[model samples]
Target: MSGGFFRGTSADQDTRFSNKQAKLLKTQKFAPELEHLVDMTKVKMDVMRPWIANRVTELIGLEDEVLINFIYGLLDGKDVNGKEVQISLTGFMEKNTGKFMKELWTLLLSAQKNSSGVPQQFLDAKEEETRKKKEESDRIADEIRRTRDKESRELEQEKLKKMLASAIIWVHVLYLKTAVGRRCK
Candidate 1:
């Protein structure tokens, strides 16, 4: 019978021990904070899920599953300390929630390129189109008003001229009749 002993590498053992120690220390230091953060994040995510889903899917034209996967990828990143940190989409809302949300919203807006949160070029183009349409409409309305005013002024002038001519003719006839009657008397 041969004596046999199985031995693993010391480096592997040290790495495993270090990882476990690091995890333990992290939990000890931030367990309460982590718990609270997770709870709050969960609540927020639940409340905003429907609206976010609708905006991402209908407005942004992205699939709900794709958005979920993208967010999950974002959350599954390592911290600066090189610890294996996992932030679930439903939990762990960090202090940068607003920033991350804004970034995601911007990404969605970029897909449409419309005015409400679009790129500068797209916004400018949309504004230009609206301005041109409004200017055209205003021009048409002003032209119509000017035409109508000119027609009204012409009609008034013609009425005045006819009245003046009739008055002068009546005065001349009355003067002639008076002169003829005086001469005859």
Candidate 2:
């Protein structure tokens, strides 16, 4: 995921993490349908974290039933639903509205992997996620309101300009009529 707005690198293993990458991702704007980027070479769904996987594609197709006979990509030598496996996130992309949401989950999951601060990060992530969402939504709403107000003000000015022009034209026409009447008298 070493792409735009994503700050991961192959050399990240040696670098000490101060949660900068996670913070960047969290603060970044949501990229729509990022899962379907054509030129962006994506890490396979097989590499997806359990957090994304559990929501994106379940390893088990059984709704409430436990996969008592599970193995690597196999359940008793047969696929889930006894027909085909549905483990790929891309396979579910057609109806998936929350593609970027999965990316957020992935980034958060990576933040904790192999780190001793997993517990603290996890707790903070949950609380911070909701708080951040509220903040962002509020900001966006305010921006939209300001924009609409500005547009309405512009529109009112335009209407006033047109009315003023029309009134001036009418005034000139009436004055010309009275002047012509006086000359004829």
Candidate 3:
């Protein structure tokens, strides 16, 4: 049983085989080719599609078609497939039109609340109206807090000055009383 390919004390042969296997595994990893399909920019999105879809379903309870439509709109109507569809964005959105429009509008509005272009000058004014209202609210809150803080500090300083003046006045009164008593004596 000891005269086969692994006979006798062949430490050099054993080490050589182990190195060869290590090198083979290092050069030829057994990972799926899909992981490195494109750039790393969308690797997380590709990997987490299932998780995102599950969460979207849980939050919205949308049907499969509705979910697909919503996702389609979110991707700006671009096909998730490897091929790039040469259709316009408006056309793409039109293709997925259904009851999902309301939900898509809500989603897009929320996303573009902070930043994004409006459809027209009138729409820009409307968006600016909301932005200005929010900014005014924040400014008013900051002003109120700053005023309150200033008043509180001024009141504290006034109290401290009064206490110090009262102490000095008490000392002067005590000195006067002492001087009058000593004079009478």
Best by lDDT: 1
Q: After superposition, how far is residue 171 of candidate 2 from its true place, in Å?
A: 0.8
lDDT of 1 at 14: 70
TM-score of each: 0.37, 0.37, 0.31
Error of 2 at 147 (Å): 0.9
| Model 3 residue 20 CA deviation in Å | 83
Tens digit per residue, CA lDDT, model 1, 1-185: 34446555666577655665556545633322222111122122342344455544554445657655555444332321111222232233344333345444343334233334334444567799999999999999999999999999999999999999998999999999999999999
lDDT of 2 at 77: 24
**Best-first order by lDDT:** 1, 3, 2
What overall lDDT goes with each candidate model?
0.50, 0.46, 0.48
Cα lDDT of candidate 2 equals 0.46
TM-score of 3: 0.31
Candidate 1: regions farther than 4 A off? 1-119
Give me the runs in candidate 3 sitting further than 4 Å from their true place: 1-128
- The candidate with the higher lDDT, 1 or 3, is 1
